[model samples]
Target: MMNGNALHTLKALDPAGGSQVHASPTDRERLLANVLNTSRPAPGPAAGLLRRWRWPLAGVAVATSLAVAVSTYTLFGPNAQPAQAMTPPPLRYAPGSESPRAVLERLAVVALKDTSRVPAGSSLYLKHQGWALSTRIGQIQVTSAIVPSERETWKKADGSMRWKQRTLPPRFQNAHDEEVWSDAGAVGEDPQFTEDATGPVNANDPLNRPAPEEPRAMGKWLLASQEYAGTAEAFDSVAAHNLDELWNGRQRAAMLRFLATRTDVTYRGKVTDRAGRAGQAVSVDSAYGGLPTKYTLILDESNGKVLAYEEELTTTAGALNVKVPSVISYFCFLTARVD
Candidate 1:
């Protein structure tokens, strides 16, 4: 059974009701199969993970069409490789010799040096491709599905924007342990919402429109706008993403300056994002509704752009006896906005 809060938040995020479609049997099977096949664990890995960490997962589950909730997925392929052969490659950047604070402080200086300007008649175009692991009811036992997804957003200074998101079918295994593609209402390929400049702006909506160019001003506006209304950390994550999306050097510098003033923000040294891109990592930790949460941003040093956004749980509250440090959601935001 879905918790009331999660259901409510999901509805709030999907006001267009795009994910409510019923799936045909054929579609459901295909989606489940994709999820399962893409998520098989290597030999001995699951047992090792389960034994090493045990924690309860709890809290208010927030669902946005862009909600990057975290779930576990075993990485495997069609031809299973031996555990010894599955080692990850070395990180491109070595862990910073200096503290995270010093690194970010230096990066802040680099950002202030940015003189890049936006092109005329250009609009912000952002494309994000990521995966989400979410729950679904199968024929017998409930299982999780990994849905490959995409989101595209175009915006201009006038607050005119069109947002589209599509989640491809997921792969999962049914009660019979047969891999299937799940078409449960969880899968959809369409624009959830789109608006032109004339569309009404909700003062409370963080994604309502373009943001202020100055960081202090942006911070003030964010507070009043409740753009990151979920938690202080949540606010930071949203603020970081939006500032990066603006693609303005001045605004980006201001964002770093604004963040410098916050006590909760911390520099997390060098870390790689989901896309295997290496960058400096900064994170914010806070409690939302008594649940501990954290959000991390991996930033490209050359351009100071945010390479990724990551959210994870700090504690195992209501989890099914899972381990801590689990990812809740993440996105590798790629922006080449003009104008």
Candidate 2:
């Protein structure tokens, strides 16, 4: 939901429908200063002196008065009224015509193929089941893990990589519970294998586990393009994938079975551009089963990828607003390639 201030900012951007005009901070500051100076009264001593020098004072006073009037008009005149509400431009892509799944599948293929472009000693950002994991390649072994709160970058003789985990605090424990991997093998013992009753484990616990045989792909096969006026079939494909990924994990067969039993999928359409992309828009919503369990999917028209996904689990008995049952959100990039 957008508040008044946020709406005002959005209006000012004139996103999609209007041109982007950037004003330098220095110019803005100078303009603001001039406006302020014009609005203020002359010093008392200056005014007294000006009265003695009537002719010169009158000329100065006229100039000052004119400046003040202009400033006042600029600040409080017709232009000061709220900007007109602009209608958003129509969407660029048509629904059902584009195959979001095929696009994503291609994107995933391209991403996997391009993994070799990552320098032998460099790193890449990977998201897994709500966890932000990072992987770095080394001379002998690749290192990867769910980054700890205290550390931001890991350095070795060959190179270094920076990473920050963005999961909610309560979810970090669950991330640590899952196995962290890199391309080489498991880097360290699984954190869940160790127990800590008195205090959290020390650095010796080895945050960098061996890389998994296959790194979890992020920014792949996103729903990039869709026709807004089309049917729900394209949206349904994305929702299906999101639900499976959100719940199935490594168990594909079991996940399929779990998905088969679910029904009551719903879609709501709203015209809006995809975040961070121009000329792309979507009408998206959620499908839910019972309370606290729902899958939210967004049909992205810009790049033809599902731009966002969220799964929430809520309990009716818990705190109303504070509790988050379970969730994930996706933001895909245009440069992001699919298979």
- Which candidate has the top score in lDDT? 1
Candidate 1, which ten residues in sequence have the lowest lDDT sum? 80-89
Model 2, 281-321: lDDT tens per residue?
23323322223334444434322234443333334312211
Cα distance off (Å), candidate 1, residue 149: 1.3
**Alpha-carbon local distance difference test for all models:** 0.49, 0.28
How well does each candidate superpose onto the true structure, as a TM-score? 0.57, 0.23
TM-score for candidate 2, residues paired by index:
0.23
Q: Who wins the TM-score comparison? A: 1
Off by over 4 Å in 2: 1-101, 109-116, 123-274, 278-319, 322-339
